[model samples]
Structure formats: C-alpha cells, structure tokens
Target: MAKVIIYPTTSLILADLVDRMGHKALVAPEAVRDRVTNPEIKSPPLNITPEEPKKGLKYAAVDVPSGIRGRMALIGPLIEEADAGIILDDPGVLTGCAGCNRTNELVRLLIKTKGIPVLDLKYPRDDTEARGFVARIKAFLEGLK
Candidate 1:
C-alpha cells in the first residue's frame, strides 16, 4: 500500500478518505498526539510543549526560524517518507497552526523535492467544489495503486 501524506494533517475527512482507498495516510500532528493532549494537564488550552533549540536544528542547523523548525519536526519526516501526497490549499479556513505562509511554502517545496505524485487541491467553498475535490482525491489515490 502507498503511504500518502495529507496536508492539514488534522483533517478527519482526508485521513478517512486515504484509508478507505487502501493507502496509509500519514498525518504529522497525529504523531504527537500524546504531547498535545494530556489528561494530567488540567488546562486544556496549553497543549504545546516548549520548543527546544536542539530539535529545531534538525530542519536547519544555522539561523533557522523556530516556527519553521517546529513545523518541520512534525511534518518533515512525513513529507520525506511519503509515496504520494494530497494538499488542501485553503487560506480561508483555519487549516491549523501549520498555516503560516513561509512554513506552508516550505512544506510544499519539500513535497515537491520528494518527487512523489501529489494531488494539490484548494479547499472547497461550495457543493460543486466539494464534489470535485472528493472526485479528484479519489482519482489520485486510485492512481497510486
């Protein structure tokens, strides 16, 4: 089965779709679920762990912005390891904390460099667009197998 990277890694719909198509969906944030939710931490809002400089160095050794590095830590591995990808490019809806312009651009670049088949689609605004979005994704996933 192909390993597919899904952008907005938190999207339930995309993840389900990828699985339904018999492909393994790699959603980066899910990798760190334990860190984001801890029942012991009573305050529900503060989900993030403090950034470590050593971890940031993985994406860029010198002069790397912490935000990009943090994003890379979650996503870089998935992008590098993906056999295929689906990008839901939506600036309107809050995709997640990974919506930073520079970080989004960097992720796209990394996916491109991986030279894997990618299905890039904008987030649907209407029923017609939504249908097309689903169709396109289905087509892409099917093509992978």
Candidate 2:
C-alpha cells in the first residue's frame, strides 16, 4: 500500500478516507503520539525532546522560526516517506489547520517537489462539491494502486 501524506495532517476525514482506500495516511497525530509516548522524552506538555529541534533542521533551515522547525521535525520525515500525497487547499479551521502558514507553505512545497503523485484539491463548500471531492480522492487513491 502507498504511504500517502495528507497535508494539514490534522484532517481526520482525509486520513480516514486514505485508510479506507487501503493506503497509509501519514498524519501529525501519529507522529506526536510517538514522541509523547516515548519514554525518552520526559518533557510533558511540551512533548518535545531536546533532539527534536535538531531533527527538524534537516528539513527547515536554522533561520526558520522554532515553531516551524518543531512542526517540521515531525512532518518532514513523513513527507520524505510519502509515496503519494493529498492536499486540501484553503480549508477552514474545522476542515484542517496546520497552525503555521509558513510551515503549511513549506510542507506543500516539499510534497510537490517529491516527484510523487499528488492530488491538490480545494476545500468543498457544498454537498455537491463534497461528493466531487471524495470522488476525486477515491480516484487518486485508486490510481496509486
């Protein structure tokens, strides 16, 4: 099965769809869960180990904001591991929000440059559009197979 990275990594709906389509959805929660559950990361609330920032630097430069670096630490590896990707552009907060515009842009750029099949879609505003959105995603996932 393809390892598909879903942009906005926060979107459960997209992740569910990808899972149902028989592909792996690379989302942020899974990454965060790894860190949170790891015994080595003793920092609660923050959940980030000291080495996390250094890991992030492999994806983002030193000049980038620490917040972006922190996020990229978790997400960058997913992007690297992705065999495909699905990105929902201009999504509302409820739909999906990565919480950092620069990170969002950087993630999108990385995914696009990965030379993998990527389906970039806009957020659906109505029932008809939602249907089409699912249809397109289904088709994309099917193609990956």
Candidate 3:
C-alpha cells in the first residue's frame, strides 16, 4: 500500500479506485486540504479531476482552521515522514471544487507531489491499446501486501 493525499474529487474516486487499481491506500486524513492535497503531493501517479469527483468513489475531508498553524503544520510532517509515496502518470479527471478549483490546485499539487518508496507509475494518459498502465499501479500496491 502507498501513502498520499488526494483532492476531494480525486479522493472520493480514490476511495474505491485505490486498491482496485492496485495499491494499499493507507486511509489518511480526508481533511479537505490535508487529507486530499497531502496524498496528491506524494501520489502524483493518481488520476485527479478539476470539475468533480468520480462516482462510486468515496473519500473523507479534513477540517482544519485556515492559516498554516492549524493544519499542514501538523500533518505535513507526518506525510514527510511517511514510509512511501505513490505517483501515477495523471491525477485523474476534473469535476468540481468548493474552495480551490481543480485545475489551479492540480497544477501546484502535481509539482509538489513527491517522496520516497515512490510507487510511481509513469503510465501514459492515452493508450486504450495498453493495459500495463493500470497493471503497474496494481502491481505496486500488491507489493505492499
């Protein structure tokens, strides 16, 4: 299993798509920003959406007071100190957002997402002709188990 935060939309889909795609998604904080954004950082490999979350996928949101002090200041460390990270070719599809727009945040998050024991899946966004892209994630996740 890999450790990382995903966006609300992405987080929700990730809930099910996670291990299903093949990775032990260590249930982390879903605290809107931390929960989702944090994982997004490390797991650059996940698929993210800017408009709305994918259906059937479920995720939690973290509720930390605005200002760096109340939030990441605490959780950020935990993520940094994590054992491993997950990254895919894409962050997923975009749907919607209440606070930050998916496109805007995704840009920053994409660059920010990185760490050790990375289960980075350098899969292509295209290729209906390929299956390894999906399998790579699954294989990585399975390794954890």
On TM-score, the candidate that comes out on top is 2
Please give the range of 10 consecutive residues that has the lowest summed lDDT in model 3.
Answer: 51-60
Candidate with best lDDT: 2
| Per-residue accuracy of model 1 over 33-120 as CA lDDT, tens digit each | 7556766654345344445334656665547677777667777777777999888777444555475667777777777677889888
Any idea what lDDT model 2 has?
0.90
Candidate 2's clash total is: 0
Quote each prediction's TM-score. 0.78, 0.95, 0.41
Model 2 segments more than 4 A misplaced: none
Query: Which of 2 and 3 is the better model by lDDT?
Result: 2
Q: In order, what lDDT does every prediction score?
A: 0.75, 0.90, 0.40
Q: Please identify model 1 stretches exceeding 4 Å from their true place.
A: 34-53, 97-99
Q: Write the per-residue lDDT of candidate 3 for residues 49-113, one digit (tens) a residue.
A: 32123210111123322322222332344344444545444444442232334332432253245
For candidate 1, the per-residue lDDT at 41 reads 50
Ranking by TM-score: 2, 1, 3
Each model's total of backbone clashes: 0, 0, 35
